[model samples]
Structures are given as C-alpha cells and as structure tokens.
Target: MNPFDYEVDILPLSVEDGGGFTAVAPELPGCRSDGDTPQEALDNIYDAIGCWIEAAQEMGRPVPQPRRAAA
Candidate 1:
C-alpha cells in the first residue's frame, strides 16, 4: 500500500454532457472523475488515485499528502 492518508470531501454532484456523474477532490488540482452513477464515480476516482500514485512513484516524483488545510 502507498504510504499516505485520504479524506473525501462530499460536494454537490453535477451532470456533464453524455450523462455521467462527477465528483471533485477537495485537495488535489485536476483530480476529479466521472462515472455512470454517483457511487461508480466514487469507485472510479478511488482507483484513479491508486494509478496516480503508482505513476508518481515510477517517475521519481513525490506524492501529495491528503491533509486537511488550516482554516
């Protein structure tokens, strides 16, 4: 498993062209995904994050920590 943490920010869902459910990641830039349904979108995005981490490691890059921002 990757050495990091996770936190999901529940935001209002949105619709996109071609009709897919979308959710946003509160922390990472350009880290969002869509799916056939809300739950699917969540699952898809979860897997996407794993791949993102793998790519980052293979390329000798640092993975971002999912820490809550200070208010």
Candidate 2:
C-alpha cells in the first residue's frame, strides 16, 4: 500500500477563544480547528486537514503540497 507521507503544518497560536486556543494552517486558509487544550487542537487539526483536502478536490482545485526544507 502507498503511504500518506505528505506534510501539513499546524500552528498553535496564543489567541484565546471561548475556553481554549486555536490551531490553523497558514498555507491552507479556512483550514482551522480548535480544541479545549493544545493536544486536542493538534488532533483536531489533522481532521481539519483531511476535510480541507477533500473540499479542495471536490472543487476541482489542486491542493498545494506542503513545502519541505532540503537537508
């Protein structure tokens, strides 16, 4: 089976919400998700990423792959 090795960065910011902070992907606008805690936010962002990718595909737009650094 092929591996899903693509990258997606999630940034956890200090901006306060109702009871917790938010996590977002700067490269993938509208791909934001929140949680009650840092760990939860990280987990939620993964789901948000999946949804974002699906939406992009359905819209017939190519989802830009995350950039990587050369070693």
Candidate 3:
C-alpha cells in the first residue's frame, strides 16, 4: 500500500509547544510526527506511515485501507 494514499492531518504548534507543525495519520492510530514546517511535517509523517505499515505487517496485524474521497 502506498503511504501517500493515506490522509494526513497537519496542525500548527504554538510557541510554547516549540512552534513547529505536527502531522498525523488518523486512519492509522498512534502514527504521527512533527517538524519545523508543514511541508517538513508531511515529509516526516509519510516516512512514519511506511514504518507503521511495515511494523504492522511484521507483527501479522491487519493494515487498514485508506479511505478515498468521493468523485
């Protein structure tokens, strides 16, 4: 499965929170990452998604399919 196929939610962090951005893959629980910018956050999350899927497969866990937008 392609990691980019999954939807990612990007949120900005406050100054107190280190002033970066966080990216999360909602469909894959506990899969998330943070970066100094939104684009960086997205890049990090994509890598995380691949790792998450790989670990799940190695553990014999079922990987959830990504939801697609309607036409």
Candidate 4:
C-alpha cells in the first residue's frame, strides 16, 4: 500500500546532458529523480515519491492511487 508503488519510467540521459538516468513516477506530478545509473535513479525516485505523498498528506491533500500495470 505504499504510495511509491506507482508506475515509473526510467530514461537515459546523454553525456553532455549530465550523463545519468532519470526516473519519473507518472501518477505523481513533479515526482522524479536522476542518478548515475538506472538502479540509482529508481531508488531515488522511490524516495521522492514517499516525500511527495507525505507532503500532500500533511497539507490535507488527496493522495492519488497507484495506476495498475498493463497486462
């Protein structure tokens, strides 16, 4: 039931563009992170999602549900 369970998209960045992977949780606006590797980007995005949910909860905002994965 963790909010970080939302579907994530990982994209690779070019060397001139800082050379890292970017992870984004599509269901949560502005919830994303970048890292030197794909795994690191995923890990960072999980933390970002948690923080985003917590902030939303603290402000009495509705937290969005995780989108089901495609079959």
Candidate 5:
C-alpha cells in the first residue's frame, strides 16, 4: 500500500516556527515534514511515512493503518 493513502494534515507555520508549511500524518506518530511550499511539504511527508512504516516493520512494531474516509 502507498503511504500517500494515509491522511495528512498540512498547516502553515508562523514566523517563529520558521515560516514553512508543515505536513503531518496523525496516524503515524512523529511522521511529519516541513517545506517552503505545501506541495513540497506533502512530497517530503510521503517519504517520511514510508520510512516510518519501514522502521516500524524492522523493529517488529505495529504500524497503524490509515483512517477510514468520511462518507
């Protein structure tokens, strides 16, 4: 399954936060990325999700499934 299938929350960061876009996968704890643009943040988070899943699998940890889509 593609990691992109997982739900992601993208938000704008404040100046104190470095003023970049932040993308986070709520289902995958600590799986997030930041970029200058929304598209870039999303792209980075995709890679992060993959790595998160791979690392979990390697350590024999349970990888959370994607949340169900709303009707």
Candidate 6:
C-alpha cells in the first residue's frame, strides 16, 4: 500500500521540545516521525508509515485501511 494513502496529523514542536515538527499517522498507533519543517516531517512520516506496515505484516498483524474524509 502507498504510504501517501494514509492520513497524517502534523504538529509543531515547541522550543523546549527541540523545535521540530512531529508527524503522526493516527490510524497506525505509534507510527510517527519528527523533522525540522512541516515538509520534512511529512516526508519522514511517509517513510514511517511504510515501515509500520512492513513491520505489522512481518508480525502477522493486519494493516488497517485508510479512512476517507466525507465529501
């Protein structure tokens, strides 16, 4: 599955938190990444999504389908 198919939530980090953006895939628990900018965070999250799916598959866990937004 394409990681881009998944929905992502990006949040900015405060200065005390090292000043980077955090990207998370809410459907995939613990699937997240951090980077210096929103774009970077998004890129990292895509990679993270792929890894999350791969790991789940290797462990015989079902990968959830991405939820679609209402039209």
Model 6: CA > 4 A from native:
69-71
**How do the candidates rank by lDDT, highest first?**
3, 6, 5, 4, 2, 1
For candidate 4, which ten residues in a row score worst on lDDT? 62-71
Off by over 4 Å in 4: 69-71
Task: Write one digit per residue (lDDT tens) for candidate 3, span 1-71.
Answer: 99999999999999999999999999999999999999999999999999999999999999999996523
* Cα-based lDDT for every prediction: 0.63, 0.65, 0.96, 0.89, 0.91, 0.95
The most accurate candidate by lDDT is 3
lDDT of 1 by residue, 49-70 (tens): 6777777779998877777542
Clashes of each: 0, 0, 0, 0, 0, 0
lDDT of 6 by residue, 1-71 (tens): 77888999999999999999999999999999999999999999999999999999999999999896533
lDDT of 4 by residue, 1-71 (tens): 48556899999999899999999998899998999999999999989999999999999999898878443
Which prediction has more favorable lDDT, 2 or 3? 3
Runs in model 2 with CA error above 4 Å? 1-16, 69-71
Candidate 4 has an lDDT of 0.89
Candidate 5 lDDT at 34 equals 90
- lDDT of candidate 3 vs native? 0.96
Alpha-carbon TM-score of each model against the true structure: 0.66, 0.71, 0.94, 0.88, 0.91, 0.93
Q: Which stretch of 10 consecutive residues in model 3 shows the poorest summed lDDT?
A: 62-71
lDDT per residue as tens, model 2, 1-71: 00122343444455553667577766677777788777787778777777888888899988876654422
